[model samples]
Target: MKMTDIEKQVGDFRLRIPQLQLEDGCIHGLIGGNGCGKTTLAKLMMGILTPDSGRIDREGLTGREITMTSQRPYLMHTSVYENVVYPLKLRGEKPEESDIRPWLTRCGLWKKKDQYAGSLSGGERQKLSMIRAMILKPKFIIVDETLSNLDPDSVKLFEQWIREIQEQSAVTWVLISHQLSHIYRMSDQIHFLSQGELVVSGPARELLKNCGEERLRAFLDRESLDRT
Candidate 1:
């Protein structure tokens, strides 16, 4: 995927960049301080918000799908099975339990398949979001703070399932998060935003360990960050 010199204005903030280069089938991390345009950039890529200038050219994604799961997931007030299988049904396809079982099992939600979706915990709800998004097998996925509400145990489970799905489907992912540890653990490349500006982008682990920028270093060093 690629962006050619895009610019966006949201109130007083601006996100300007000359280019964004993403490798196919890799985990890309998006990190920044609060209101630094991480989610905004994600929205732009999703076309939920239009850029003020330039273009977002999704190279090689002409016939493929692009999907996103936000920090706060959208789950209907229905059974977990319904929530996970809704997308397939929406596209005039049958929602088969057999087809959906592996995804539910992968996210540790198979036992809760018949339960009410709204009754699940925050972490479980997030898992449902992941399951719903991943079942479609989109070519590209934007994960915006999907791990924010999870506990340590849930985080590990979520990461495992995510890795499994990614490996199985070979999808390119853009993960936006305030959690630097997750960014470090899962990302192949990293993009940083500061005051709505894209400050830097490069290899993930190297960016975390070697970036000399004060704010980025502080952000990387912080034990935890508030969900944005």
Candidate 2:
């Protein structure tokens, strides 16, 4: 999917994106300061919001599902098993326990399968959200600050799971994270949104090494310190 000459207005906030292209089956990392339009741009690309001007040409995206996983996943009052299997059930599939077991185990939630989903800890909830969103293996997925609540260990496990999944299937993934290390680790390309505009776009390593903007350089330096 590609956005061409995109412009959007949300109350007083305006996002002007001249050209943004999402390639097939590549990991695109989005980073920015708070309220810099990082999330807003992601939503626009996913068609969650309509641009006031310009067009999103998704002609290249055919026979595939474009989905998103939010920071806080919405869940019903149900068992862990049910919460994970619900998306599949909605798509006219008779999902079973066995079908959900592998993912549960991978995410360390197998024992909690029968427990109420709402009762799970914050990290567990994020893990559950990931499982539900990933079970179908959507062609393109946007993960927006989905791992912000996890502890160090949970974060490591989740990152490993994502790596393993990507190894098996080539899915285009867009990860939006405040954690600079996480973004640097997962993304092949980095697109930085600043003050409602896409300020930097390039390969992850090159962008960091060659970053010249005072604001961006400072942002990177600060995040690096926090990470360490």
Candidate 3:
């Protein structure tokens, strides 16, 4: 997918991107400090928000082929199993136990399958949300801070599933996170935004290791300090 001369204005902030390309089947990290239009860019890509100027070339991707999950995902007051299978049912696809059990079991939610989704812990809820997103096997997925506030064990589980999906399928992922560790570990490419501009973008390792932008360096330093 590509964006050329894209622009969107929200109140006093305006997001501008002259050109951006997301290679297919790769994990792309969208990173920046708070209020830096990272989520705006993501919303634009997901078609949740329309650009005021310029066009986004989706490379033939459709609404059904794309999905987005946020930090606080919406869940029905229904069974965990029902929550996971909701997307499938929406698409007129019948829910299959054979296809659903593995994800539930892998995410440690199989035993809670019959329990109410609202009764799960925060980490468990996030896990269920992710499972619901992944169950569709969408071609393009935008995960916007969905891993935030999870325990270490849950984070590790998420990491493992992310890597496994990348290895096994041609799914394109745009992971938006404040955690640099998650971005550096999972991203093949990185896009850094600052004050509504895409300041730097390149291979994840090279950009992180050799980034010389003052704003980016400061952000990285701040994140490191936060860790301590």
TM-score of each: 0.89, 0.92, 0.95
lDDT of each candidate versus the true structure: 0.83, 0.83, 0.90
Q: Which 10 consecutive positions of candidate 2 have the poorest summed lDDT?
A: 219-228
Write candidate 1's Cα lDDT for 111-193 as tens digits: 99999999998888888888788788888999999889888888888778678877787788999877777777888999988
Say which candidate scores most in lDDT: 3
Q: What is the per-residue lDDT of model 2 for residues 43-160, given as tens digits with 9 covering 90 to 100?
A: 8877789888999887666433777878888888999998887778778789877888899998789999999999998788888888887897788888898899988887888788
Clashing pairs in 3: none
Per residue, candidate 3 scores C-alpha lDDT tens digits across 135-200 of: 899999999998987887888899898888888997999999887888888889999999999998
| Number of the candidate with higher TM-score, 1 or 2 | 2
Backbone collision tally, model 2: 0
TM-score between model 3 and native: 0.95
lDDT of 1 at 69: 92
How many steric clashes between backbone atoms does each model show?
0, 0, 0
> Which scores higher on TM-score, 2 or 3?
3
Model 1: residues with Cα > 4 Å off, grouped in runs: 62-64, 222-228
